[model samples]
Target: MGILSINMDDPMDVDALDAFLKIAEYRSLSAVAKLYGVPKSTLSLRLKQLEGELNTSLFLREGRSLVLTEAGQTLRTHAADILGRCEAARMAVAETLDDASGMLRIGATGEFGTAFYSQMLFAFRRRYPKVQLDLSFFSPHTLYLPERQEMMDAIISWDDGNAGQGGAEQLWTDRFCLYASRDYLARMGTPATPAELEEHQAVMFRQPAGPQLWLLQRDAETLSILPRSDLFANEYWTVKYFAVASEGIAYLPSFFTQIECERGDLVRVLPGWESAQQRVTLRVMRPSALSRRMGAFIDFCRDYFSPGYVFNGPRYYVETIFNPTNTTQTGEQR
Candidate 1:
């Protein structure tokens, strides 16, 4: 028989549980101590206290590796679960604070995330000093889970392609322009119209043939301008580079090449030819409504990337007053 029976009514030693869980995740005492900014001796003392309470040899040494014993592994799983619950509770408490302070996990496409509103990244850090914003970038062409429930609090993608999803805000829209380096244009004659794209060395964004297909439209006319390129890249930025290095003609966002086009680093072909529309939309993944922190973020975008800036579509004229009328006819409205 055991020396003593376990008491069912005793409270859990949360501090010890936290330390143990950290040790398990990292698999090294020194690592955990370094992470927690504490001495190894202190961590060892706490681990011993936990083992004594549980009455188990929680770990076994194998060369330089620390392996969890059978008993240790069992306890570790439960310990992690308990620690997770505690963290959730802590998060709930922190969320209730007046200021929006906590982690905001965000996911977005590569080029769009950096290019469209790079300023917002800095602004968010400055404004919400307490909020830890983590942005995970993915390729725009890749299919990702976008219902707003998994792996992200918010997302940025092409609006036209991803309509009727959850809470969405139109960040900006820019017409695609044909870009080729000066050398490439000199080698291959500059295309004068959409029809001529078929005759050129084109690098195309391959779309799967389905109902949810991308249409290359110009001036409200959907042209059968199915241009092809031997060299293909999923990232929009990569396409720009290919064009600059004389790989092929790439249809890319106007604003992305604004500086390049102005400086003549890459020449814009077919100025009169309207390129396809690309919409940069910000999406939130919440069940019913948004939190205070989430709402604040949306407002921040509205103020920061305002009209006449990134959000201003092709139809927007400098002199005319800006309004988000659903009637605005451009490649992408939002």
Candidate 2:
């Protein structure tokens, strides 16, 4: 037999209901106590207190098992459901404690994520030591997942439909230039004019096959190229890397290669005649409540790409402007 009666004005503790549900499921008070890391007497005392509050006999002893009464059956069903929902709510709230902490996922093309925008790695770390940064490279289609916004926070990519409607904004742009590793030039010689590029081993971006069309602009003059691509990669950074390894000449976005180009590791293939300058706008999206962490990333990039002013951090950059368009170089317009 158990306590029985009801007090309508008094509220039963939710934790007590959870304990009652666990005790009913396990049928052994000791088992529920051990599972909860409490003494068996504590479980009994709490259950007794709960029965007293509800003023009902919840359990009746039948040999080793404690059978549930009509009231117990009702409370057990409701208790499991309510406690399950409470646990879910707890996990949901725990995820938002961005106290400037936890993981912040960012996406970008390999070329852009590595070269210019990576400055945020050092800068952001200096500010938020507890927050972890997960930077993913270009390609395989896994890098950009706009459909799963809960997992991916923001992305620095072309203003494609990836971000959707007002979720994305134009951060800025990175100008492009023609380049080849010094070692490659030492062996194959350099392209004195854009026309000579056809005769050279050229590394190209992610395209299937055949000769590619390269459009170059200098003032009102536009030089269109039908250069032969001897090597191919799915991403721009990979193309630049192939060129750096002395594979061949490559056209690269300016910001990331500035440090390497200045170091003479990768030399300007056509220093006199500027290659086509490509401008791609960086689109970032972090909707709903995680805007603070997303804001930190955006601000960090804004400071790093502040036109001509070199980032005085764990990163490096040279102040070089191609022509016509000039503002703090951030990303690409794509």
RMSD (Cα, Å) for all candidates, in order, is 11.2, 15.3
- Whole-model lDDT, model 2: 0.65
Candidate 2 accuracy as TM-score? 0.55
Q: For every model shown, what is its TM-score relative to the native structure?
A: 0.61, 0.55
Model 1, which residues run further than 4 Å from truth?
Answer: 1-92, 95-98, 117-119, 138-148, 206-220, 287-289, 308-334
For 1-334, candidate 2 gives per-residue lDDT tens digits of 3344557688777778877887886788877776657788878887998888887888988998888988898887777777656644653564677555555766665555545557757777877776677775454244455433333567666433354344565556645577886666877888787778878887877544543455576677778775677687756766766766667877766666876777666787776555553444445553555445566667766665567645557664432222223233332211
Worst 10 residues of 1 by lDDT: 312-321
Worst 10 residues of 2 by lDDT: 325-334
